[model samples]
Target: MQGITGYELSSRKAEYLKYIHMQGDVVKTTEIAANFSVAPSTATKTLAEIAKAGYIEHTPYHGVRLTPTGTAYARFLVRRHRIVALVLSHYGLEPDEACKEAKKIEPCVSKSLTDRICASLGHPMMSVCGEIEHDCCCCCPSGDHET
Candidate 1:
C-alpha cells in the first residue's frame, strides 16, 4: 500500500524540520549534523530525500530551507509532539520519559487526535523536552525574548 505523502514523514525528517523551523532562515547541513550527532554525509542524504519529497529546498554547499508546505507540516508536528508530551506528564511519567514517548508516537497521530490531546491537556505552552514553546513563552522564563 502506498502511504500518503504528507503523513509519510519519518521521525528523523520531522525532527530536522522542527529544528529548522525553530531556528528560522536556512539551516546548514553541518549544523544539523552536529545537532543530531550524525555525520555530515548522513545529514545530507536525509535532507536530499526530504527535498525530493517537496518539503524542503537544498542548496549545494549552502544549506536547506523548508518549503511552505514543509513549514506548515513541521509546525503541526511540533505542536502535536509538545501537547502529547505535556499530556503524558499528567499521567505520572517523568518529563524526559514523556518527551521520549511523544517523539516515538507523534508521527503516527492524526491531526484530530492531536487536537483532542491538546484540548484534554489544557493546551500546554511548553514541551516536556523544553525545546519547544508556545508564542507566549518564546524565550526562557527568566530570559529576555530578544536575548
Candidate 2:
C-alpha cells in the first residue's frame, strides 16, 4: 500500500484494474479487450505493462489476477470514485450523473485529497453508487482504525 497510489496509473490502466477488482477473480485478456472495445493484442500489450509494474500476474493461455499491491490500489481507486461521486451528487448532480462524472474526475484526484474530502463528509459509509469502505491509512477515526 505504501508504493501503490492511485495517481501512478493512466486512466485506462486504472480502469482496467478497477474492472478486474470488481470482477473479484482472474480475468481473461479477451474479456478485458471486449470490455474496453480494444483488440486482444492491444489488451495483451497493455496488460504486459501492467504486469511489469507488478500490479498483476499474467499467465499465458490463462488469465490475470491482481497482486496484493494491486488489490490495495484498486480498492483505493474505488473508494476515491465513490467519495468524489458523492460530493458531486451533493453539489446537485443526479446520482447517475455524479457517478458518470466521477469516472472523468477520479484520475485527477489524489488519495490525500480524497481522504480529506471523506473526513469532511463525516466518514460516510455509503455512497449513491454503493457502500463505502474505509482504510485507516486515511480518514478513519482513531477508534475505527483497522489493521
Candidate 3:
C-alpha cells in the first residue's frame, strides 16, 4: 500500500488483478486467456508482466496466485469500482447500467477521489455490486475493512 499510488496499473492489468482476486485461489493461465478471449501465449506474457510487478506468483505448471500486496490492491480496486457505480446510480442510472459505466470510469479515478466520494456518501456499507470495504488510510477511521 505504501508504494502503490492506485494509478500504477493499466486497465487491463487491473482487470486481471480483479479477476484473480475474485477467483480467491490459484488461476491457470489458460483459464485467464479463455476468460479474456485471448491466446494462451498472450495471457502467459501478461501474467509474466504482472508477476514481475509483484502482484502474482505464477508457477510454470500450476497456476497464478496473488501476493499479499496484490490482494490488498485488488480489494482497493473492487472498492473503487463499487463506489463509482454507486455514485452513478445516485444520478439515475440503474444498478447494472451504473456498473457498466463504472467499468469505463473507475480506471481513471484515483484513490484519493474514491475516498472523497466514499466519505461524501457517508460511508455506505453496501453497494450495488457488493459490500464496501473501508480502509483506515482512506475514508474510514477504523482500519478494519470488514467493518
Candidate 4:
C-alpha cells in the first residue's frame, strides 16, 4: 500500500505504470484491464494499492491518474523501455519484436544502465513504434544536441 519502494514493485505494477505513461493523462481501470487482459476488478485493486503507495490518484469512479512522484517513476520506466527497444532494433530485431523484448527487459534494468544505454544509442528521440523516447535528453537536452 505504501506503493512500490526500493524494488518492491511487482511486475504488474510496473506494467501498469508503463501503461499509464504510454497512455498519457488519466486512464480508466477498464482500459487498463483490457490492455493487460485482466479483469477490471484486478486493475481497480492494483490502482488502489498504487494509490495508497502515493504513486497515483484515484477519484472514486472518475478514473486513475499518476501523481507527480508516480509520473516521474513511470516516465523513468518508459524511457528505459523505449531505449532498450531502440538498442535492440539496432541489433537487428524487427520494430514490433524489439518493443516486446524491451518491455520484457525494462524492469530488470537499473536506471544507471538505462542511462548508459540511451547514451550508447546516441540519445534516440523516438522508438521504432513512433512513440517518443523516454530519456534524459528528451527531458533536459538542448536542441543543439544530436539525437
Candidate 5:
C-alpha cells in the first residue's frame, strides 16, 4: 500500500521501528539482538527485510536508522499502543499490565479502529508509558499538536 511506510505493515515491524526511533541514534545489530532476545543473525535478517521495504537504512555488521517513513509509522504505532494501554487500564489493569496487554493487541489495530478508540478515549494526552501523541493525520485534521 501507499500509506506511511509504503506497505501493509506488521506490528512486529512497527516494534522494531519504534525501538530504533526511541534510541535517537544509530541502533547496532547487537543492541537490537539483545533487546529482542534473538541471535544477531536473526536481527540482521529482520533488519535487512525492513530495509528492503524502504523504511530504514541498515548496514550489515553496523547499525540501522529510521527513514522519514519509518518515523511516521513508529509514531503511529506508539500512539496506538498507548491508547490501547490507556483503555485497558480503565478496565482495572495496572498501567504496566495494560502496557503488556497493549503490545499483544497493537498488531491487530487498524487505522480506522485506532481513530475510533482515540476519539472514544477523549484524545488522552498521557499514558502509562509517558506522553501520548498521535500522527497528526490520525485524528487531528489540522495536524497540530500542543507543544
Candidate 6:
C-alpha cells in the first residue's frame, strides 16, 4: 500500500491516477476534469484526496504530477486494464468496447488473479490502447512481490 497509495484506493481515484499517468508529466487540472467528465471543482476535491495520500504532487494553480510511487501503481492498473480488455475481447467485444468494459472490472482484480490473467494472455506486449508494463509480481520469480 505504501508503494501504491498508502491506503486503499477507490476505483474512481485509481482512474484519475491512470489518467495522470497517461499524461506522462504535470497534468492540467482542467484536463483531469475533462477526461473524467467531472466538474473542475470535483476534480480538485478528488485530486486533493489523492495528493493527500501521497500519490501526486498537487499545486492549486499548477495542476499535478505523479510521485514515483504513483507511477509504479499506475503501471499495475494499466496492465490489468489491458489484460482485462483482452479477456473481454474473447467474448466478442470490439477492442475499444472491451477497453471500456475492462475499466469496470480492472480495479476489483487482485494481484494474484491479474498474474494468472497475464499468463493466460501470454504476457502480451500491447493492448488496444498501447504498451503494457509488467508489474513486479509478474516479473518476479513465482509471482512474489516481496523480495
Q: Model 1: which ten-residue window has the lowest total lDDT? A: 138-147
| lDDT values for all models | 0.75, 0.86, 0.87, 0.74, 0.78, 0.79
lDDT of 4 by residue, 1-147 (tens): 123222547767988987887788989888898999999888899899989987899876778889988877776766667778888898999999999898777778776676666666566678876654443334335543245
TM-score of each: 0.76, 0.92, 0.92, 0.81, 0.88, 0.85
Query: In model 3, which range of ten residues has the least summed lDDT?
Result: 136-145
After superposition on all C-alphas, the RMSD of every candidate to the true structure, in Å, is 7.4, 2.5, 2.1, 3.9, 2.7, 4.2
lDDT of 6 by residue, 9-116 (tens): 889999999899988899989999999999999999999999998889999989999998787777788777887888888899999899988988777787667778
The C-alpha stretches of model 2 lying farther than 4 A from their native spots are 3-5, 141-147
- What candidate 1 gets wrong by more than 4 Å, as runs, is 1-6, 122-147
Local lDDT at 66 for model 3? 100
Clashing pairs in 3: none
The TM-score measured for candidate 4 stands at: 0.81
Clashes found in each candidate (C-alpha, N, C closer than 3 A):
0, 0, 0, 3, 0, 0
Model 5 regions lying over 4 Å from their true place: 1-7, 142-147
Report the lDDT tens digits of candidate 2 across residue range 1-147: 465446888999999999999988899999999999999999999999999988899996698999988888888889899999999999999999999999999999988888888888878888989878886345675635222
Which candidate model has the greater lDDT, 1 or 3? 3
Measured with C-alpha atoms, the lDDT of residue 5 in candidate 4 is 29
lDDT of 6 at 100: 86
lDDT tens per residue, model 5, 1-147? 125332246766778888998897799999999999999999888899989988799987679998887777777777778888988898999998999999997778776777677776667788878788764445766654444
